[model samples]
Target: MMKYMKHLLVILVITIPVLYTVFLFGYHNQTQTTVIYHGINLFRGEEGGDQPLFEKREFTAPLSYVILLTLTFGIVIAAVAGLIWLLFSRWEQRRRLRSEKREERKERLYIEGIEYYFQGDLDMAEKIFEKVKARFPAFISPYIRIADIHYRRRDYRKSLELLDQARVNEAKRVDIFLRKAENFLALDDLGEASAALERAAEIDPKNLTVLEYQRDLYIMREKWEEALEVHKEYVRLVKHRRPEMEEIQNRLQYEIARKLVASEEGKGKAIRALREIIRSEPRFIPAYKVLGEIYVEQNRAEEALKMWEKAYKEHPEHPILLTWIEDVLYEQGAHEPRMSELYRKALEKSPHDRLLKLFYAHYLLRLDRVDEAEALLGELERTGGRLPLFSIFRSEIYERKGRFKDAIKALKAAYGIHSFNEMVFSSGNGLFEHPLHRQRTVSWYTWDRYRINTGQELIPMPDIQRVHRA
Candidate 1:
């Protein structure tokens, strides 16, 4: 009813002015009348005052002229109104077009900036992004790109500032919130990162990017349960089942179970969690490892051995599980025959596995079977792709056999092979062209220090002596 009344009001407002104009003109046309007057001519000096004045004449406009005048006035008013409306419409259209062009230009610049960013031209990319931000302050893309550049440069504070500016422009945007969370995480501000992610979750609870970041944050803070929940949600969001996702979730659950096993009250829960993981993902080796450790902690040595044996049967070439199995057997004083049998069977299945061979050879060496270990090491050496560890083992065997000179030669060979591959010195936390050189130098220095401590002859390397002189 109100709508109809408004429409009626609009119609009346427009018609009233036209109707009044027509009515007033029509009334004037009807009421108008012609009038005539006769008077004496005062300026006529010769004529008598009473002499009749010249006949007076008068004229009145025709009714047709009044009607023509009213029609012409209405037409002129209507034409002027139409012309004004047309001009205003054209102006509005031009304004819209200009706005669209401006938006297009901004989008183009943003795309170009992204391309430059991908091309690794950070300077050019930064300048273009800055230009875009300056010209289009409300545009969020450039703000984010610039923030990313700052982040790559490790300028967390500046990155956060740009992200804050973006948030101000678009408070509800999830990407902006995620970027802020990343910046906070980079700065080790876990609490602020969580808060930012929470805000993003409120905006879009099922956003995959938001959930992934939330999971990472939880993991960083060691909030295992929260991370598990987020990972589960992420798996559900994905349409297809992925093996990696299942593995990640199981690993997280395994970690949680491990943490639980640390407490007396939570042991039962931990065991149940571990069992559930094994049941769900039998091939997940870490679950078996953790479960075996839990069983061993509970003094259930037999159960732990059974778990490891089962894992070995399922994954025969798993080096870690094989090592655990050997350790368990040795602890139980039943290692000899069982250890030999396990290695033989595993080698039969995967004879080309060098790491497995190394493990076997090391085990043999531990058992004082030096000849057998040497035989395996010789076979590995003759195979033409010997590892440095092989030479190290050979040196160990040579030392055990009282062949000091041969041992040193083997050690030098190992060092030379290692120099080409090792780029970082583990001792000093530095990189070098030949890490083995640094290692040998450091070892000699350490041995000399020991000799000095013992009042023995110091065997300093040539390089070390030069350094000491310098």
Candidate 2:
């Protein structure tokens, strides 16, 4: 019965304005009749019924009187209605203002709590926020803000507690799920975080924030397949919001493909996955490097070389690829002539690269070009570089060339920079019984910057060089 009364009241309230409009039009039409009635009645009373100013028809029936009575009644009803409407409108405005003031007070308190939080006054902040929650349990903002305070303080447990309370209060709010998930993530609770993200995604799959964080969770867990799917969804959202990330999209695809390869075991399938990465982002250098490494491990040196060469062509200044090329050639120990040519070509492109210069010098030395090796070493020394073993090699070359004094001088300089162990010889030209023991002793003394003293005394160069030549 009450519901029916309420419905009827609503209907009447809606129809009142329409009724008022009809009354206004009806009252306007009655005004002319009332004015004519006043003129006719006055003249009829002043002159006799047959006066020239007053026709019998004008005085007949006093029709304007009825019109005047009707107009008076219409004015009274309109005035009453307008007074009632004005009173009701004022009442309603006051009621709304009161409600707005109450909300404004609550919101101001909530804002004060947030300010306290920002000022690092956690006790005051928590107190004010708790008051808000108690006063307005129906409001989600208090719960959200209080939980955020806990999260900011790294109190994940307390944060979850507040969020749980929020759920108990309003179990259907989407914001609760998101905040809960964020708290779990801050706690490093990936399982809970993933579950929360999944729920949030289910509720509002268009939420790209949830999808992105969930995708990262999947990646951390090494759930590559799930990660790939979620990343695809994220890319779609990104395409809608940011159309300029086309290159980034390709790179994401490449990463997904690479992770797929790493997580799968079948060699054939992994290779195909790697190839997919290359197809998606052809300039992804890591894919090429990994492919080359795989090929090298499989003893397919030629294919490895091809991949490295391609990488070098794409990024010509990449030292790692150049190093790979030199390493591959050195391992194969073939085509010495081509190796030298390649080394020179790479050095010409990057003259200041010390590693390239070292490789080039070694390649020249391997070809028995001692003079070139010595000249290169000299250049490195002039640039204040330190090559510990190069001086020894130069000294050996000098000794082989019969430049004994230059060899000795080079040996002395090498000794000053590095430890030069002297050889011991017997006059009878017999070998030391324990060469290993003597070498170990010499190495230790040399490393300690001490000269090796045989207690027996020092030996001459003639016999030492003779033994060394032997």
Candidate 3:
């Protein structure tokens, strides 16, 4: 386009000057010429001179006719130039259209590759894309397609080689960089993967896919600090926030806080970040547990108890909170008053809550409040059927009251266990234990799901504080 503009400018530069000169020199009127010629002739006639050369002026026309003739000449020249330019433009446009049509025809084979790819005929797709690659070398789609086929076939090195070729053909292709990064990640080449992602980010900084990939890469490398930063940007750029995204952000934030807590210098910042997470995500039970531990590690028992109590009061189903609270108070023999009042208040709020009532029963039995514990057990059995933990809790009551034989009878009858062993109980360690590691010990928390990590897949907590507040 700039070339065409320069040519037009040159034509204008030459034509305007010539047209201006003609208008300046050829602007003569016939009246002025006639007066001069007649005056000169009259003088000659008076002097008896026969000068036939002074008859008229042939070069000058009338004023209006001169203007008309000049306009006509300009119109003729302009028409000729305009026609030539129009013809040239049409020819160039046709040439471009033909080239585009040829490219489209080459892509027709690419369409067959796509059809075969979706049909799961990878071998044919590979062949078709290879042919397309040879014919349409400038375009990166065929290379991308072939690389994808290799990736599906688990030929990661081959996939990467094709992607490298694509990158050479089109260095600015973000998809090429993304695919190369993926292939590198699959091959466990973090250095190459990082380089690819860095290039992609430089090309398009705000790309959501690039941000997600970076976030995952950092997380896989256990670079919690970097992962947190990338995840924050990802969350900010997301148009619609999803529950899974919230969960991911929570995990990243918690991982960072955990790392901070691990370092002596970062404990205070970790505490602050954990508190922020707890405020925004009250249902996230791990944040509460970790924050409590941090306080306990510093010998800040009072603060830890207060924090755990605050959380337990809001979410009674999370047995971990109850465990943390009672374990602190039980050793000192001061759990009665605090735990009693807390359970009373929780029962008042959720009176129909069987889990809370059952937890209170377990606490009572552990304290040797056999009568109250028995009453709750009977109510639980009558209203909500019996759980294995219920039988275990009853045995706990009998054991607390010095009825060892009946405790053994109750456990054996409920679980049909043939083994015999001592059940060591501790408020801090566990509620019940098998004698020689032959059976799984029952924990004081008596959590629902067994055989998993502590505090995992516990009951879903209440929604006093929802997610995404921050």
Clashes of each: 0, 0, 1
- How do these models rank on TM-score, best leading? 1, 3, 2
lDDT, candidate 1, equals 0.72
lDDT of each: 0.72, 0.61, 0.72
Q: For candidate 3, report its TM-score.
A: 0.59
Once fitted onto the true fold, the runs of candidate 3 whose alpha carbons sit more than 4 angstroms away are 1-83, 235-250, 263-265, 326-470
What is the lDDT, from 0 to 100, of the residue 58 in candidate 2?
A: 33
For residues 236-300, what per-residue lDDT tens digits would candidate 2 score against the true structure? 77646643233334334445555545543644555665677667656555566566766776688
TM-score of 2: 0.56
Q: Which ten residues in a row have the lowest lDDT in candidate 2?
A: 461-470
- Which residue segments of model 2 deviate by more than 4 Å? 1-69, 119-123, 168-175, 239-276, 279-283, 294-300, 326-347, 351-470
How well does candidate 1 match the true structure in TM-score terms? 0.67
Give the per-residue lDDT digits (tens) of candidate 1, residues 245-289.
766676678779878988989889999998998998886666777
Q: What is the C-alpha RMSD of each candidate to the true structure, in Å?
A: 16.2, 20.8, 12.8
- Tens-place lDDT digits, model 3, residues 1-470: 56766766787777767666655654543332211233235555555655763566346454544554666688678868876887899899999999999878887888888999889999998899888888878878888888888887879999999988988988987888888887787777888888998999999999988887777777667787797788789889889987767666766677788888878899998999888888777877778878888997899978999988878778766655776687778865788788888878878877897766777787776776789889988998899787666776777777777788887877876566765453443321354433423332211111122212221363321221111100
Candidate 2 Cα lDDT to native: 0.61
